[model samples]
Target: MEIVTTIRREVLTLPAAHLGPDNPLPPLRPLDETHRVEDRDKEDLPRDMARQIDYAPLHSLLPVRVRDGYDRRREPRPIDTLVIENDRLRVTVLPGLGGRIGSLVHRPTGRELLYRNPVFQPANFALNGAWFSGGIEWNIGATGHTALSCSPVHAARVPAPDGGRMLRLWEWERLRDLPFQVDLWLPEGSDFLYVGVRIRNPHEKPVPTYWWSNIAVPEDCRVLAPAEEAWQFGYERRLRRVPVPVHDGTDRTYPRNSTYAADYFYEVPERRRRWIAALDADGRGLVQTSTDELGGRKLFVWGRGPGGRRWQEWLTEPGTGGYCEIQAGLARTQLEHVRLEAGGEVSWMEAYGPFDARPDGEWTGVLRAAEDRLEAVLPRADVDAARTAWQPYADTEPGERLATGSGWGALEVLRAGWKLPGTPFDESTLGEEQQPWLHLLRAGSLPEPPDSRPPGGTLVARHWRDQLETAPATPLTEYHLGVAQWHAGDRAQAVRSWERGLRHAPVRWPVLRCLAVADQEARHPERAAERYAQAFDDLGRVRREAGDDDGSWTAVTAALGREAVEALLAVGRTGDARSVWQRLDPATRERGRFRLIEAGLLLAEGRREEARAVFDAGFEVADLREGDEVIGRLWGALTDEPLPEHHDFRMRPTP
Candidate 1:
């Protein structure tokens, strides 16, 4: 069969020659041994419980990628690029790269609706690290780039019921042990694309999962949504309610005035139809809307500052100014906030297309006009007709089923029974493990203590102490004991326990992390810095040995190294802090928190001109008091004046 290559609308697959061994995608790291459990029967459990409960291995773990010594010279390589188009809209998908929509073009205007990266560049960004920025990335399973991102998936071209064509991408996520598929349908004469997603748990056991479709558009675009309130986590990690569209009397829809990067998750008003759009000044932009099938619309803005600009460079090639993400999810917020049940499945359909603003209209008016246009573009008949034709594709059998069409084999067309997404299912939520303390102890890698309901921190610490006295000091037991001691206000004892654990289990990253925190709290900056640095090194060694090098582990180590820098700065070790800052990846330093630290270091070195330049590059200092103190100290350091007595120049970096 001859492959069609034309401007006419069609779905065609092309080979991706850019991916190879020298620049291979990051591999998924296995669950940490502390969290791994062979079986509950192997532990000293009650006889009745041991006989009745069958504990399956918690295989669906957090996805971690290790990126140490990664090759940055790799060019973009897509396994297969599927192009679907109509006269007004054209979309390109890279099935191998997490089935991401590589590019979407408004054909009539010849403008790209999505931020199309010239290359497939994976960076240490997502929660799991190794996230590619441009285009639309499908995040399934855990919150970060789903385990499938940067991995190949099953793809096929199927006939659309509307006499057009559809491209299907399906993958079995090993970690979640669930199957998910996304079908991109382009009808014969439609200007918009219909996206149908289905996630099913084929196992008898219940699974927890998340589904988020992330759409990237131009950074400076204004976001218009039907929301009056939003949910955001503050610097202290506390969730707070704030006004949507505007916060603190400032419109958040536009990025120009913001001083800091922020993520706003909105509780979209309950309505039959919900929509969100990112539009340029001319009113030409991308719009996304869905039926009640999906909820939780969000806007992730990266401010147009030095840190944001540096991140854009890190995420993509130069000249493609940073882009903002308009995300839609299935749950209230992120993945950890929701779960899926056994034999249960969730399905949803969403529409994406281009819209033009009304002439001489303000942003609010333009938004209302866009909504009116969307209502007309996405009618009930069109949605129902597409759903009627696409139901069979989503209702396929669990695994290895024959997908009859287009001369494709069963294996080539349908793949199923992959891992489910998200963290391990809480056993306490099960029938047998009802004891709260027992569940906590088991999850923490500790044996059931004498008192299942240890009411207070003191009691918990005593129980852990008794267990340590009776049993050998293994890394897990020591770490748990240290946590209990810390909770009981025995910081010194906790430090000792962590130190002892490190001596016995020298490579335990968790123990080192605990020790570092304890040192920091105890005002031992030097010791804290040392412990953090050691932990960073230990994580790197483990990643190398496991051959799981990617951004996930790199993110952890980079964070630890940043903590070390902060500790060094606290003790006035400017030279050491500068050395550590310089050693960080340029991309990591480009983050807002690190940029501030870099400027402080330059100020400490008496390079006033360089420090001023860094400050002028746009720093998102949210706390006015802290910002003032830092500035005051820099001034005092340069001059011979004494610094203010109450001012604390050292500040913890915000993520």
Candidate 2:
């Protein structure tokens, strides 16, 4: 297979097209009026001496672009197979559309597209500057040494053989007018667009390159992620949901209000490389932000004002709005590079668009359903203890406890040859074998104390309901709930519960173990991270309370610690998480459990080298035996990729 990559460049000049009615970007304002005096002082100093000065004009240093006009309805010959248009825009498809050179974000807009390079702007300064002083400024400016080019363009579209496919080049008047489009196509659908640009990289070493979709949202918007807790700046309603230590060592609390305009970045440090973010699209979009590979990857969100502040107050600013950035690398962090032996190709793509939260569940439901069915076969004895423990609080809102029962019930129904009572879940949509028995569990929110038992038995159901009520309500509880929710097809609810659990009780051991399981099911990682942190705290506390000489806690603590590290990997926070795991007590570290956890996390992060190291280390404890169920779930959570064909099940041996 052929690979494609985009070289990154810095925007040195501002384009005029971005100054239209919708995008009114303000110029970079100087910190002090005597800007010329400072410039002169630096002009005469030694090159090295002058470089030491932290000199950054938040607006001036930022690359600005303005594109005039661009059409999506036309393109050049031979490549054109068809032309299609709606009242809004046109599309063209060429031979290379699906090949390497395809444009990831290309579409026509009514007005111009001008945005200041956020990577080089004030937000970057505020977040990175406080600690490094000028160090952050210098690193950012130094890396931003790239040339800027602009093209004036107008609209056009080219067609492909398939009705949904199209390819073509558009005319541009300036940088801001570069067109972008979001096309949702059925299988076998295609579309393509081409535009011209000038790019340059200044580093001695060829640095990897990537771009971000600078999208603007209207005043009213709501955001959600699968994370239990999130990084908080000065956003509105920032509260410390999860007590994970902040990188800066400050308090770990989030704001209380829900409205905010500052940039909040979340890092997803796992290997699956899948992500989902959504906003309430019913109202005018209420967000704006940048996506640059230079910053850490994952997701970076910006809104009108601080959480709880009115949109009008925030949006009225000259260049203030909400935004969600899609970066080629981790969000809020710098780009990472992998050194190839000799010949190397580094390719990336940046994308951003309006999304309906409802549809995301529809798209990924197949895998989710399969996972749900897989767990349904376990006997109640395996999970019944957890259920029995929480039944007292069953009167309370099930909170997340609802999910554990749901997941278990789903598995039970499937093993018993049951199915959802609806048309979509029938044999046609999901073959009889794949049909989920849990769908027939309930109609509304999980009823409290109401007799809703699956076909097999009530002991397991009773156990789950009991634990749902009186449990410490920690991360583990949330994780189990999230798993249940996921299996029951309450996708959004499952994610929300997991995030909430992690936020409030991150140090709980159960949460970390379950977070890994839940995130794997959801195809995301942040929640798993929250769970990992809680697990670490839980195991650490146990060790401390047991005293240094306690060997049992040492082994158990190391085991839990390793599991936490694995959870971090499950959610894509391997680098830092691994560092934390490695620092455990030496005795605990000797047990191969840590290595196994490390291997699992590395595998999740796609670090085969690191994973292999841990996998090899596992041989030291090769003779150790684990309960069959633990081994099965551990394997399932770690290698959902090419899932293991047969697990060592107590129920039966494979022929």
Per-candidate clashes, comma-separated: 14, 107
Worst 10 residues of 1 by lDDT: 404-413
Supply candidate 2's per-residue lDDT for 217. 27
State the lDDT of candidate 1 residue by residue for 145-258, as single tens digits.
Answer: 565566666666555556545676776564464667787887655667889888887666677677788999987778877777776532223345678666888888885656
* Predicted model with the maximum TM-score: 1
Encode model 2's per-residue lDDT on 1-655: one tens digit a residue. 2212111211222111121111111111211111122344445543432333323222222122111111111222222122333322232222111111211221234311212122111111111111100000101112111111111111122222233222222211111111112121111211112111111221123323323222222222333322323333332222121322232443211221223333343433332222333334331111111112223322333332322132221112225443333222222322212221222222222222222233123223522432233224222232233233222222121111100001222333333343212100112223221222232233211322112111111112222433433544545445545554443446577667767876775244544554555565565567656755765666566456546562434434444465557656655676767676776877555544455555666666677677655543442222122112344455555554532222232212211
Per-model TM values vs. the true structure: 0.58, 0.26
What is the lDDT, from 0 to 100, of the residue 517 in candidate 2? 52
lDDT of 1 at 193: 84
Instruction: Give each model's whole-structure lDDT.
Output: 0.58, 0.30
Angstrom error at residue 594, model 1: 17
Candidate 1 RMSD computed on C-alpha atoms after optimal superposition onto the true structure? 13.6
